[model samples]
Target chain A: MDFFSQWVAFQTIVTKEIRRFTRIWVQTLLPPAITIALYFVIFGNLIGSRIGTMNGFDYIDYIVPGLIMMSVITNSYSNVVSSFFSTKFQRSVEELMVSPVPNYVIIGGFVTGGVCRGLAVGGIVTILALGFADLKLTNIFVTLSVVLLTAAMFSLAGFINAVYAKSFDDISIVPTFVLTPLTYLGGVFYSISLLPDFWYNVSLINPIVYMVNGFRYGILGVSDVSLWVTYGMLTLFIVSLYTWAWYLLSRGIGLRQ
Target chain B: MSSALKISGLKKTYGNTFEALKGIDFGVQPGDFMALLGPNGAGKSTTIGIISSLVNKSGGKVEVFGKDMDTQPYECKLDIGIVPQEFNFNQFEKVGNILKTQAGYFGIKPGLAEERAEKYLKLLGLWEKRDEMSRMLSGGMKRRLMIARALVHEPRLLILDEPTAGVDIELRRSMWDFLREINEQGTTIILTTHYLEEAEQLCRTIAIIDQGEIIENTDMKSLLKQLDKETFVLDVQGDLEKVKSIQGYRINLVDEHCIEVEVSKGQTLNQLFSDLSELNIEIISLRNKANRLEELFVSLVENKGAA
Candidate 1:
């Protein structure tokens, strides 16, 4: 297919995907906003009053970026995993597979859907965070770039998960076990600087730490890791995940017999 | 003058041991309505799956309108539309959106996609339910929706795998008419159906596959001609005691009112009717004991099993 044709196909998929999530706004959009609202109320207002400043910032403000990153990660990951797996479950993915659209277009379209949802829910959570704690721009470029990369990376992760998933139950296992734990431990609620030496070193290995700390740095002008290290981690993860996803799709793994 | 579809030694093996399609080869001329008949596990679905790129081929070549599938799969897929045996579309999507989305996948623009979606939906009697969720459609309506979705791209080669497997007789006949209409309009159709009567009524050519091999591939007339004799049941309004035998045909009394007669290729039913007339029997109604193609299909598959 020509480039223009592929673009149309890609746009069609993205539109369908956006319509899918928006059509079920209660399930896709509302729950994350409500859940993050409660987190801000309980953790930021109620709990942060007891804890003093960490990393030279108020406890509530310190946790805002982490909370936003968490929502983005989970929402982005869940959107692709659930949507793509549902497409496979219903066998509607065949509609794309049988068409003239290339594999990259398919991947690009779904990833865009995931990114959109992630950013959307992220925006909602950020607005909610403002009511509990004041948030100011530390570096608008860093903030936008880190969140975008994080959402795209996790969306790709979810796509890979959906591809290998055989059953609906299989789709939930990764997010519930791997993603939830990784997000909680990735310096969402605490700074790695507060951890014991060995554990602080271990937390550095968790990829989500880079995202959370990077976003925190973007928001608060403070970070446990170097800006260069954060960018390198995000870039490396995005490139590797995108390439891996493209390879799997081209090979027709999990999607075809 | 390129064939609409051509399969050369097409092969598919599932896992390590199960060979779904074994070096099958066939061709459908442009605008030909071809029936691919087979018993269960005979690789009919496998061939369709491979052609639609749902299943990977183990070996050999598939060419659609002279476009090599391997070298130009997008071009090949662009020319063909397939309706799988199972309902493979999203049930939650609106009926109209299903057709529109399908057209979009083929890179159709919004304006033309809307026009074609409307065209096919109306053609298949789905216009009223266009905005309704597809899952709410009845079985027959769902079948029609699939047909409409397959046509939105206006493909030259349309393949339906058992399109009317469970449809009521009336709806089945209507679907046959719709399929025939498209075939008449120059879309080559390859249909796989368990209903031999459907095949006999709609297809001009036939291919019978068994045990992953094509046992018969010929025009429908030629395949039917190979049947040495045709058995027909006659409902006669007379007592069996009045009739003893027929002259040139093998006759058996099925019941007091019905009798089965095997008429050979060179024989005439006029002779049997004359003999029945002599017996003072009045023919109420007469019909074939089985569809001609059904008999041929059973015999062909049975012979393959025996071999």
Candidate 2:
């Protein structure tokens, strides 16, 4: 197929995926909006008042970027994992597989869909956060860059998880066990600087830490790590995860017999 | 005539064992309606999968319209469409979106894709249910939806693997008519069916695969001709409790109303009728005991097994 056709294929897949999630808005879109609203109410308002200021800002303001980044990361990862795995379960992935659509196009399309949902939820959560905390952006470029790269990286990760998934249970295992723990420990509720030297050092090993901190730096100009190292790590993760996902698709692992 | 699809030494092995296709070879001429008949586990699905690029082949070559599959798989896939035996579409999707999405996968523009989707949906009797979710469709409608989806891109070659497996007789006949129209209009078709009568009525050429091998591949007429004898069940008007020995025929009393007769090649039915009439037995009607091709297929597979 020509480049134009590949583009069309990619657009079709992304559109279908978007339609799928939007069609079930109550499940895909509404739940996250409600969940993040509760987070803002409980963590940012109710408890934040007593916690006072952290990082030279109100506790709610300090956690706003982290909350938005959390939403982006979780939504992006779950979207691809669920959508791709459902396609495999229904065997509808064969529709693209049997067609002349390239593997990269397939991977690109699903990841784009994931990114869309992640950013969409992120946007929704940010709006909800405004009611509880004062939100401001220190660096628009860094904020957008970090959020986009983080979403892309997790989308790729989700694709990898879906490819290896044999059942619905398999799809949820990583998100529930690996993802939630990392995101919570990655400084979504509090900055890791408050922790002791040992725990802070251990927290540094969590990848989500860089992503949340980078995004936090973007929004409030506060970060525990160097922005350069954060950007480098995010770029490296995105490229590596994308390449790995593409490799799995090309090899037809867990897809073709 | 040029071949629409050519397979030479095609093979597939599952998990480094359990060979599914043992280097099978066959070809279909452009515009010819051919049947690939086999029993279960006879590698029919494997062949269809390989052609459609759903299954990776372990060895050999496949060419679609002279395009080498290994080097030019996308181009080759562009020329072929497949309706697999199983329901593989998203059940939650509206009937129309499935077809439209399939067209898009082939890089069709939205406008043209809508037109084509409309055309096929109407042709397959699915236009009325275009807005309904696919999961709501009955078995037959779902099958027709699959056919419409496969034809959305107007592929040059169409492959149907048991396309009418669960379809009612009326729907199956209509599907055959639709398929014939496409084949007549220059689309090469390869159909895999368990219904031997379906093959006899539709396909001009036939390939019988068994035990991962093509035991017989020839024209339908020639394959039927390979049957040395045809067994027919005759309804007799009068009952006669006697055994008659015909020199070149085998006759048996199935019951009071029916008698089975095996007529060998070069034998005349006229002589048998005359002999029965002389014995005061009136013949009401007669029909073949089994589909002609079914008999050939059974014996061929059995003989291959014995060998």
Give a tens-digit lDDT track for model 1, residues A25-80: 99999999998888887887888888888888888999999999999999999999
> Per-residue lDDT tens digits of candidate 1, residues B15-42?
9789888899999999999999899989
Report the C-alpha lDDT of model 2 over A94-132, residue by residue, as the tens digit. Answer: 998889998889989999999999999999998888888
TM-score of chain B of 1: 0.97
Top lDDT model? 2
Model 2 lDDT vs. the true structure? 0.92
- Runs with alpha carbons beyond 4 Å of true place in candidate 2: B243-247
Q: Report the Cα lDDT for residue A257, model 1.
A: 84
What lDDT does the true structure give each of the candidates? 0.92, 0.92
Q: Which CAPRI category fits model 2? A: high
lDDT of 1: 0.92
Weakest ten-residue segment in model 2 chain B by summed lDDT: B239-248
Clashing pairs in 1: none
